[model samples]
Target chain A: MTNASAQAASPPWDDVSITVIRRDMLRFARMQLRDSGAAEDMVQEALMAAMTSAKSFAGRSAFKTWMFAILRNKIVDHIRASSREICGADLAGSSDMDAGLEEFDVLFNRRGLWNPDDRPATWADPEASFEQDAFWTVFDLCMNKLPEHIARVYTMRELLELDTAEICAELGITRSNCFVILHRARLGLRECLENRWFQGEAR
Target chain B: MKMMNCKDATQLMSERYERTLSLRELLSLKVHTAMCKGCSNYGQHLDVLRQASARLRAGNTSGEP
Candidate 1:
């Protein structure tokens, strides 16, 4: 089919190509900001930016991927601008991870322990109880509870679809350190979710 | 079979699972996991968590959340 004919045949937003991706972008924004209003704003901003800069897309990657990249950059910009006061030191130094790690070390050491191995294992069958809204609510709560640095790294890498190398460069961390941060973030989230959603259900 | 320490296994299996490890590192992890129930279980848990998170995120996007 001709490109025009194909384009005409597809619904503007219902087109399978962009529909799910757009939704994912919105969901990611919500998860990252933990505010539906801000998330919707980010989605609209990303959509506008993508549409205006369509020519710059280059088509080297999927359109959704490109759109996500734009959204991620926008999110980072929003976060930076919004936290200007708290992250002034982070903004001044190129190495956010180093500064973040130092802060984490102090906090973590003060807590007198890193691992929560003493806590009971609490695994749930996602297949049965995996309602989306509830999951994200729990997920968001867990993510928000994480240390700021770990959460930032985890969000950028997983939710924003950034490469580890890019995250390392942006956060001024080595690949190994990035993985360590991510691992800790994941472990913490797992425990949090288990306690809040899974185990709580039993009680 | 012996079990890998949680700390070391967490590090090794994480990189291995992400496909970010070098061949040598990957081989070492494979060897370690071969005899390590704890590492194996950790890997399983990580995989489950990843899938569950992705599904949850996708569900939210589709308005099921």
Candidate 2:
């Protein structure tokens, strides 16, 4: 073994506290479930699972990473169970965030060229805005404003950092369609941020 | 390969996050962004948006909305 690997201390997973991460876990669950009651149940189950499997944790990852991994697996299962009950109806409709197409039309013509007027102007002081808490608030609001299904897809792909195949299997979307949905989500988010945060108050 | 316009370039820019681009797509995006100021500006906006998203998540772990 290398000297660095031998010297590196393993995190004390045994003393890890679940209470500390409870709120963050709940917030993440609520974002995915949009239902507080279900979110609570999921969090409870995740904590229980973590406790049971604490001995199995080899400390290769941080305590928080291990905990959240359990929580995310619970979420994936929850999404799967809920979609199953709906008989593929919701998952079938998952990929259709095409309502944002009109916004795309405003930016691009039938020939796929960006409209001259719609070209983004130089954003004023964008880097500085990242330091402001209020900017993140507006950014959060804009993200929440995305259509429910599309927002979920974006959340799964971007926030959860799930791979495309996992997302496709969980959401029942084909790869090509999944890419289109994510693209539209980014476009919609970009426009919303432009209107509400970037150009709105930054100017 | 079709002539990439500003619209296609912007879409490709976003897709770069989710998947690998074809060589043709990359070359097209390169040529298009090289000449199109609008697409280039959009690309920069995307970079800021990505950074903002990362910062937002970082703050979230501390329990802020």
Q: What would the TM-scores of all predictions be?
A: 0.63, 0.74
Per-residue CA lDDT of model 2 for B1-65, tens digit only, reads: 57888777888998898778999899999999999887887888878767764543332444222
Flag clash pairs in model 1: A133-B65
**Under CAPRI classification, how is model 1 graded?**
acceptable
Give the CA lDDT, 0 to 100, for residue A45 in model 1: 91
A1-203: candidate 1 lDDT, tens digit per residue: 58875554432344685667776777678767767898889988988887777667655555655677788789888865665553454533546544444332321223332344423243556655555567666766887888767887777766656778776666556777788788777667766776777676644
For lDDT, the strongest prediction is 2
Tens digits of per-residue lDDT for model 1, B1-65 = 34334555556766654556777666766776677554555577677667755653443334354
Give per-model CA RMSD. Answer: 6.2, 4.8
Q: Looking at candidate 1, what is the lDDT of residue B14?
A: 60
Instruction: Name the docking class for model 2.
Output: acceptable
